[model samples]
Target: MRSTTYYAHGLNIKSELFFPEFPLKQTSEIDVIIRFGITNLFNDSSKNFREIYLSKFIQIKITSCNLLYLFWNDIQIFTIKNNEIIINPNTGLDLNYIKFLLFGYGFAILLYLKGRLVLHANAVDMDNSAVVISGVSGIGKSTLSFAFHQKGYKLLCDDVLSINIGKKFQIVYPSFPRIKLWPDVIKNFEEDPEMVPKIHDKTSKRFYNVSGNFSDIKKQIRAIYFIKVTGDIKIKEINPQKAMMELIKSSYCYKLLNHHEISENLSQCSAIVNKVPVKILEVKKSYESLNKLVEIVENDILKN
Candidate 1:
């Protein structure tokens, strides 16, 4: 297997897949090793798990020992065994599924298992600090980060915010330099959506390469913003209790958490809320209003 060593979320990962777009560095020591191989993941008859989450397209099981089984629609199955992940992809599976598996939710869970506070947020660097922008899907987290990129602010991470929680501070690690954008977002930038390359065939979303628009350095989080798309443009500071609830709600794969994991995750959220400035940002969804919304957020960040 061909392997490449890369740095992401402040960890040295030796992955069998050739993900060269990340900040690559050759190293003899590896913190996490990812391998592409075959396994009978569907045959979990003998294995035991304490918590289970099932849906029409996905099934996730978390063991009492903290082991995880993530199955993606029969296309792929990921079994996290310690620091190593054995990915079993069906024969002749679409390459898009592989990309989605590796980039989308794969590493998020891995980071969670590694004891980092992972959030579904996009982050940008401003004044030597990271400002995290989070919300539900389609709420324009990445689009706003892209707008910040246009203004010369460095994009720290596009999707996942792997946080290093200290006593009085929280630092968000840098991710790979790419942002996924929908057709509407491209149109808002006055760009032809048809010209952009789609990330997957099942969706209209495309990957926007932010190689030059990103920073290689991770930064301490100075603020967090939860965005709402259908309201008048405004920003409001959220209290710690409310921020904790919002953080838990916005977490990726939160439903699969066991009782212990849920408590730990909530504690982490509370810690973050206590230390960082958390706020709710309400902005109207329109091409004409995007710039004004960016300016509003910029002003808030500058003042605080």
Candidate 2:
């Protein structure tokens, strides 16, 4: 059986984020392990599949899906047919619907099971620390994430960040370059036409999907920045308790976990608070302001 180390980092509390699971058990086999989280897991937009699915990934569909919890019936797992699949009730993952969930989906599952992630958000290694930027949607997280990259900080991730907690909150995620910025805001970064994709509106806002030169730079979470979007721009430091709240508010997939397994998400964030410093990055509408904020983070975080 092939195995690997697993990590979990939550938003409000700290917990052991390891769960030993076999890889073959995950694929090409009937044996299965299921987990649960703190949310409904099955969110119904009733807005139809079009609004729910992305414009880039419309090829896959789930017209007839069974959106029920695996734990809706039992306590301990029981054996089904040798070819049948068992489910994790507390997790929002719907194994019956598809072959595998994306990275975000898997991360959410790990958190639900109270498993920590080895990496998270947009982070960079500076003097042996992982400076990380995290926030809710439309909070200029991407603006700040890529800014560090431009300043010679290796870009780690764009949208989602995960942290693995053992000795501390060791951040982890696959190599991803560039950030998704508002179409109108792309010009400030010297918008390279080649990097910008065709502008498309998914939910009334224009999305500029862009790419960067370095796409394989991954690192740990040395610092945490909660980008706060408002009518103006500013930067400040918050206490650990407040930092934990912001972490929860900016949690990657907390609400998406309908199965009520939120212990892990909380645990990951707690680990960060206990070990790393979490800060607040307030930004205004102007990209110049964003630049100033970036400079502050780089000067303070990257240098120290």
Candidate 3:
């Protein structure tokens, strides 16, 4: 059996399946253990049902047994029990599809189960502090993060930003050493989009490896920026009331959780806003605006 240890979002996971995008770590104690195996159908006898997130293609289920089950559009199922994960992909389906889901939503849900606060954002390190950038899908979170990385900031994580809250401060843990970007975004960075490896055969998005620009050290979060597209570029601190709302909105899988789960995360989100500066960054969605956008964030976030 192939096995490896990957460090992601403050967890040291030892998995039977290999995830090349994550940096290898040597640890005797593993926070999570994963294994890829044959599929098992969700038991109808299970009760205390909650649909974490449901789409036409995929749905996540939480049963009375506390098992978190992720069904991938008839192609595969990911079962998480405690710290152990079992991925059961359809025999004939492409493994790449399963792989893509596993790293993205699969890991986010697992981290939530572990009680680690996870955000759907990309973060970069600036002088040992984390600046998190979040927005709705296709708002260029990863692309802007990549731009920060090119400008000498170490990329902390992309897509899923996990934070550890403490009495005095919050720390953002480093995630995988890669970012998923669309073809046009890759082209903006002066790279051939075609040369970038596709995330899955079914999608045109590709992953950019940033091993040299990756940072494993956890940093105290300095600010959180919720980006949006606008005709003109601007950055401003968000009102506390709106910041709380943005925090709730930017959280990973917030819609899928039960009322209790939602309440718990809400408290966490409320507490986080008290410590970190939550701001809105508005900019035009064009390559010509990226440099100026980065400059504005650096001046505001790094200086404050």
User: lDDT per model, in order?
Assistant: 0.79, 0.47, 0.83
Ranking by lDDT: 3, 1, 2
List, residue by residue over 1-304, the lDDT tens digit for candidate 1.
8888988778788888677557887889888888877766336554666544444776666665566777766554777764877776553656666667667677888888877788889999988999899998778899888888877889899887788778878878898888888888888788888987788788889887778878778799988999987569899876778898889887875776667878888888888887888999998877677788779988998898
Q: Candidate 2: minimum summed lDDT over ten consecutive residues — where? A: 15-24
**lDDT tens digits by residue: candidate 2, 1-304:** 2232222122211112222211111233222223232322235333232112212332212112322222222221211111122233434334322212322343343343344443235565455456677766566666676666666655555555655666744655433333456545556667654455432322223224323433343356667777777655556879888988877776654543333336766676787788777887777767677668877776766454
Best by TM-score: 3
Estimate the Cα RMSD of every predicted model relative to the unseen true structure.
2.1, 11.4, 1.8
Order of candidate numbers by TM-score, starting with the best: 3, 1, 2
Off by over 4 Å in 3: 39-45, 89-91
Steric collisions counted per model: 0, 49, 1
Candidate 2: which stretches are off by over 4 Å? 1-114, 117-121, 124-128, 192-195, 198-218, 230-233, 256-260, 302-304
TM values, all candidates: 0.92, 0.57, 0.94
Model 1 lDDT, full chain set: 0.79
Which one is best on lDDT? 3
